[model samples]
Target: MSVWDDLVGQGPVVEQLSSAAEGTSGLAHAWLFTGPPGSGRVTAARSFAAALQCEETPRGCGHCASCHQVLQGTHADVAVVRPQGLSFGVGEARELVLSSASRPTGGRWQIVLFEEAERATERAANALLKAIEEPAPQTIWLLCTPSPEDLLVTIRSRCRQVMLRTPPTAAISEFLVQRDGVDRETAEVVARASQGHISRARSLATDAEEWRRRGAVVEIPRRLTGVASAVVAAEKLYQAVKAEAKARTTELDEAETSELRHALGENAKGRMPRGTVGALKDLEKRQKSRATRSERDAFDRRLLDLASYYRDVLRLQLGAGNDLFNVDLEPELRTAARNGRPEDTVRRLNAIMQCRERVAANVHPQIAFESLTLALRTG
Candidate 1:
């Protein structure tokens, strides 16, 4: 299939990118792809990069060497910069700028795809801005972010903007069934629960553990019966989240340590080099920072899931007649709506959102969760 096939419910974006790949009127030296989470901004950018490098008659013929190479991230002329930590630093951006200044080795346009451009530090943005302002004749840059306002005005000004919309639930369901071989029932459940987040839908559809965790999250509202129960629930949630984050980080941490040790020429019998100790310490520090960010992101997602359950409850209470994201939990949602006042649901939603803000502001997750649980109990 074509690289564009994976981009669900973005037909207009596909058409624009495809036409540009074919040397149509909308072609530009730089492009900014903006969309909400899971809108496939990065996927669209990669597909466009592949199409640009494709040598086939229609362009982006999936079987062509250029197309395959770009899609597989093996193309010499293509570079993808993804920040593993919370933010992209000036050092990394400068290196990318230098790399993008070089001519393409494959006799086509050299493409640089930067994901999460919103995370670029001020210095990093400045570095990127310089490159975009005076790009190499054979170079192209594609930056992906949640929105245009998240990027520097200067950077946004120099690039052609491409906006992507959330994929419909039906489209997500179909893609899961066709591409991932998921059962239709499970696919639909995950798609609706994801609320247009393709990645979350895939995870929920394929991972039993994720489904179980979400089940627990949706039950939180019903479980907050008193202050003691709320505290216990908050503790449980925090511990579970931390455990999951640790499980995800452990293997990556070990691999990174091994790689760093090897790079420092630390073998089984060799003594440590003079500066290797400091280098290893720095690497560990960075790894810790990345792990913290990962844990925060995981916790934030759990908060969002919690909020969605209450949102469904709120919708039911207000007779909004909107489709519920957590359809499987509708009975519980209706029970809560009937038992609690509409104002209570709104307060709980506000509490969850405030917890998210507190966590983002570096408050202890345990404290934030505990506060949120109590708010739910008393709201």
Candidate 2:
């Protein structure tokens, strides 16, 4: 297998990056990779970085020492920066810029990969822009985000753009079965349900808990029969998202706290050192920000799941030929389509989208989900 093997359904992107890794003239010092969520932008960027360091003839033979080191994140010349909170601040951007000024130690290039460049603050973007504008001869920058428009115009203009498409459902299904050992039926179900999100498909295919959560989300329409039930369902959804976020972050949060205390010598005396209180406060603030973002992300995923279910209902009502995303819930979907007017389904979808916008605008999840469920109920 080559480094490109894991980049599912991105043949054109693989070809372009491979040629560049082979010393093509079109290669630039900075590159911006844009794609939808779970479209593997980060994976593609990492693969390209590994290929640049590969010592093998085809440039990305995954068996080579350099490739292994790069993939494992132990390469001296390669660095990856991923934001832990809601945004990447100027301090972190400056640190990365300072690091990028160094020349390559072992590989042909010194590479810096930034995941989610869209989350960079204005000052952070300016800091990155300076680095990109005056990069070292051997330095290369790879930034990943959902779209070029999410970045500042100045920063994006200085970088070569690489666009990635969402992989087809069939491609995702095949990848899940072949790579993850997921059975074909489950693979197909997950592929359609995930709407081309590769990571989500893998989770739904491999994890029963994920499937149950999704089932709960999609079944909301059936449960929202009265005001009391809608409120109850809304509260349950909010709690579910909070619980998911806590489960995901609890271990990492504790580890980070322990590391900070050890670094500050708190473990030696069971008390914080002088001036360490401020540092601890900063850490807690960042963790809280990260927790909030994680909960919102979980809630968004639930909203998307709910949207896809209604979309299936709409398609069934219209007699559309496209495959339903909620194929496993066909009986429930058929009942929904039979009972609800097509106009009502459209209203329900609009309400769901509006709820997403509201949540993004900092509205409380309970209020947003309550309104959404009530709209779904009335529809």
Candidate 3:
């Protein structure tokens, strides 16, 4: 086994990283990893970090202690920077530069794996550019973003780019069955439904709630028979998306709050010492920001699922005959296709995309979904 095992359907990426790990060529102080969501961009960066710090031959040997530590995020010389809120500010970037400039305690590379580099603020990006421009001898920076255009051109130019493709449905299905012990049929269903998103495929196969949520989303098209039904559907969809987002972040938010309270000398009854209000407020602000981002992401996924239903209808209308994402809902899709024009399907898809843009611009979720549902109903 090797650290690259978790990276599905990325043989070329594995070859490039492995060769670099072996010090043959293509090694650089800064590396940029770009790909679509669930395409394993961060996973590739982490695996490369492990390979660079491997303790055995054929670097990234999964059995080695260094590899294990790196994979588990406990390695002394490797730091993982993940933005907790919507934006990573300049203060964090400056601190990261200072921290990463130090020599490695393990006598190897001082590696910083930065996830969602696109979320860095303008000033933060400038700070990062300076660090990348004159990195220390043993320092290596690995940045992950959805696309090269997300980052400043100068920063990207200085970094060697490693582009990862979305894993194929067959590869995702095989991985689910072999690694997660999912049944072949269920794996196949989720693999196609996920549309090349490996993480979503695994979640759908393993999590009953995730599968149910997706089912509800894909069924929205069928429920929009009238204005009243559309309005009700919009409210329900908004509530469900909000609940999922809250469920995902509530545990971590509570844990961080409790940890911070304890660190600030909170008594057993949970009363904190004096002058701790500011810090608690800051933590609360960050948590709120994180929750907002989570809710937006959940809504985006639901929108995409809705779009896939219309996509299948469009394909049927056009005689495309391609594989459908919602294979289980074939009858519903066929009915929708038979009843609606391809132009209507296209219009509904545009409405969903517009709703997504509105939400990203901080529009109220209820307003966005209500608008989207009405458009779908009319279309």
Candidate 4:
């Protein structure tokens, strides 16, 4: 029912954050909040920022105008920057530094939130460090990343770190029932299935399209019977993942490219500039890198889904319980696990990880994924 409740079952994190809200630790100007995706890193940052800005007693009055604006992203003091295409380059970092250096208009703290600080390039990280080292008197810098290893040690050394843990299934299920109005049966199922990924739990509780997509992916392992089938599955994954990556990055890339092209004027379009060729090549390189990262991220999500299906199969093979992600596909799980060994399940998981490593290393995605499908199909 409140912003804090949106974060699944992080009672310990909530308690620590609440203490921080009450002016504990002298209110350090910099904080790094790190966790897995869907673990409410940004959500925690926003709530903490709102609590910082609230004038009401005990802070974080969700009903206050300040909290309203802060939550809605219209507040003057709190600024959140989610990287557009891929990397947060020096230009973006400089803008963030400038915003943080300015006086807060609302007479509270100026909070700059970096969502996915792991995506910041080395140059951008240095730019951010300069601002953090000698910050504005009233400014607060909050960085959210998947892990501290993703950030420069120099930058992290200056900030207080808040580590987030995935909540237990019981707490997660209770959270959904009390705060989201979800029924107990559905809530418990989603809680267990999501493995404490709060946002994913919520989506699984409500979304049908997601189930269909995951269903298609889980079914592919069993359907790979021939070279043609394997190739088609590989292409299906590539096209699906590539389309998603393109959908996310294309508009942003075009806008940035247009801006650069416009700034150079009509003479620079086809005519020679001393550095034009190099810049073009550099741009292409970064774009390709970003595309690969996005595709891998998407594929990883699917792999996790496949792993979950296998997990359910493991439980079923042991007669643990009736828990199933694809309630409609339970018979399929029964059929598949019926023949698969515990070692076979392990081999499949390892194959998925090996495929991920290949993709991360910039292997040709089509070949890598195709090999993965074939290996898991018959290995």
Q: Which candidate is the best by lDDT?
A: 3
Q: Write the number of the candidate with greater lDDT, choosing between 1 and 3.
A: 3
Residues 258-377 of candidate 2 have per-residue lDDT tens digits of 999999988555888788998899999999989988888998999999999999999989999279998999998998888888998999999999999999999999999999888888
Candidates 3 and 4 compared by lDDT, better number: 3
Q: Considering summed lDDT, which 10 consecutive residues are worst modelled in model 2?
A: 265-274
Clashing pairs in 4: none
Clashes of each: 0, 0, 0, 0
Per-residue error for 337 in candidate 1, Å, reads 1.4
**Global local distance difference test of model 2:** 0.92
Model 1 segments more than 4 A misplaced: 269-271
Q: Tell me the TM-score of each prediction against the true structure.
A: 0.97, 0.97, 0.98, 0.82
Runs of candidate 3 with Cα error greater than 4 angstroms are none
Clashing pairs in 1: none
C-alpha lDDT values of all predictions? 0.92, 0.92, 0.94, 0.79
Candidate 1, 1-379: lDDT as tens digits = 8979989999999999999999876679999999989999999999999999998878888899999999999999999988888899999899999999999997489999999989999999998898999999999999999999999999999999999999999999999999999999989889999989999999999899999998888888888889999999999999999998988898999999888888889868867778789888988988888899899989998999999998998899999836889989888788888998998889989999999999999999999999999999999
